[model samples]
Target: MMLRVTDQTMTMSAQRSLAASQARLAAAQAAASSGQRIGRPSDDPVGAGESLRVRAQIAAASQHQRNIDDGTAWLTTLDSALGSATGFLRQVRDLAVQGGNGSLNQNGRDALATQIDSLRKDLLGAANTRYLGRNIFAGSSDAPAAFTDGAPPTYSGTPGDTVQRRISPEQTVRVDGDGAAVFGTGADSVFGILDAISADLRNGVDPTGRLQALDAAMNRVVAGRVDAGARLSGLQRAGTENMTERNALEQRRSGIEDLDLGKAVLDLQVQQTNYQAALAITAKVLQPSLTDFLR
Candidate 1:
């Protein structure tokens, strides 16, 4: 009876040891297959919390990258509008130079005047540039056109309307530019000068001062175009910087979040070897049963 009782105790101890070994092997297998130690909070609460924080950071960085791209696209639209506007102003300037020649008879001047009118209409259309259903030059009004049709193209919006674009954490850049500065105001406006010239031409009046006014308007437009170009350059620089930083951050985040395939494969192989050894040991230990002892 004493010998049988001792044997039973030994068997139970061996069974418990084998069960622990099997549990460890299962854990190693799961870790190798999943490639993550903490599947849930129940697996490792502290590690899960860290993973959540890292993931949130990565998401925020990705969103910031998208913001940078959107800002750049908007700036590109603005640049395109400015380029077209520059060309329109150049047409007006050419007309001004042509009209300045006194050798032109009344009929010649009238023809040139008509050409200027066509170009002015084109300029007005250009001023109302829109991208994605939003007016780029309307000073945040979202108006269909920056200027309304009349004797002189009149502004229907306020001045100095601006918008901010966030390029980075704690860093914001201004994207919107005031329309009045570029278009001119009151008597000095391109539309105003063009209107005066058109009226003088209709009255059969010599538009000597009107030609000079066009020259002045041309200068303003050129200067404004240059300013717009500078702003676009700045936008490009800022966008490039933001992209570089964001990409670097993404790389860093990947280092933390993404599995190292080389290291992971090595670890998996090691775990497989360890698990197989444990299995072999367990199989040997588990071979003895009550039936074997009875036999």
Candidate 2:
């Protein structure tokens, strides 16, 4: 029997269809096994673009959240160092009050004067607080102290070049407190007040007059600490907000980009079944060719 032209074309068309279906089945099986929607842009251009967008958003939000966390940590360090400095200043003020009493003999006052001197040195040392190898209170200067060593405490750092670190898109906070603003006043520096108080107590001069000035210096330090503490509180709040926001963004991104495990497993089972079925059908279709069909 002679085959018609239409029958020959039909056989070739069916074979191509089976081959194409087999290829699709194999790709679907591979996709299910790997648990990804798009292995290549040609596989699913629309889905691939969406996944890329979600991934980019996730990366950006994660980095922003990290920045907020890092900034909060740095601010926390500043608050701690300021707390320590405040304690040192208050200690010196307490010494001033105790030494002001005239009832103590020269020996007692002399010894009290010595303690006061040591406390002053401690206060100055405390002013040189550093974090990450950079001065926390020394503004731009990394000097041992914010004050001059000789006689009066001199202001060391400039104001304009103060360091400010970016904590967020719209926010930048000062990383280092201005040393001059923190310590030295216009007329007399913190060191000057401490020195004058120490000298007055040692000479049996009018020590009562120094009490007001010493307390003022202590108050200044405490007030500055409170301000820094407030700023730190703001940063902590910002970090928390950023964490929550970033988590939400990541959740959305995951929904858009991450594979659904349950669906992927089910799809894998279906694709595997289909792939096996296709191979069996293809074997039958390609086996014995037109000779088998006649049989």
Candidate 3:
């Protein structure tokens, strides 16, 4: 069978070829300018889904880092207060030792008692410390302070549970310390210990036994500080891990979402050359049409 060749069919074919060349040129130029591979979901469906997932992971990791920062601050504030409390307790122990000496007369003992009393108040102040206007040792309680003033300071903080912060998918940190555990609950607490020493000195009673009580209170404060240090270490470790993971996710997303500028530029040049060639061919082929001869 012989196929008939027609001028109209040739013209239509040339127009279609030119349109395709122009479309390729436009796409290449867009890729060069935007610097992203996934302009639309249809560009690369699998790559687009992966990019979205990685971006969401990055956002979640960022939030985790923020939680770690906040938790670190809370622990730091609590630790500072505990350090001061430890110092005050040590001073109280020294005073108790001086008061315990038999050579010290009642009048001398009274002066030591006064200083111990002052230090006890300072210790109480440290126990009732707040970070960001919330009691750090009060667990979930919204109380301003953990302890109330009294002969034996009372724990007004309802330490229901340890306060926790989420630093990552698999990790959570305890940000609050147990107040009743560190300082004692009521009149039987460290404040009570100091008050007993004061009363004994005024009543001509020897305060030597009170030295042991001071030692016990100092131990509690020291232990609390140790716990805070451990928590701080964990927070730092989690922060480092989060940063590492976030970097990896960003790199993976860049592979899926960002353009290879070198390749895009080369492609754009090739497409431009092809489009120009197509335009030249279309002009040469259409120049000898019947309409041109009539003109």
Top-lDDT structure, candidate number: 3
lDDT of 2 at 280: 81
How do these models rank on lDDT, best leading?
3, 2, 1
What overall lDDT goes with each candidate model? 0.69, 0.70, 0.87
TM-scores for all candidates: the values are 0.80, 0.83, 0.91
Error of 2 at 199 (Å): 1.2
Q: Model 3: per-residue lDDT, tens digit, 199-224? A: 88877788878777768877887998
Off by over 4 Å in 2: 1-15, 42-47, 140-148, 185-187, 289-295
Model 1, span 209-273: residue lDDT tens: 66666777667666766765676676677667767766776665455445565666776677667
- Pairs in clash, predicted candidate 2: 148-154
What are the per-residue Cα lDDT tens digits for candidate 2 across 181-230? 67764447677887887787788765668778777776777777777778
- Runs with alpha carbons beyond 4 Å of true place in candidate 1: 1-16, 34-38, 41-51, 185-187, 286-295
Better of 2 and 3 by lDDT: 3
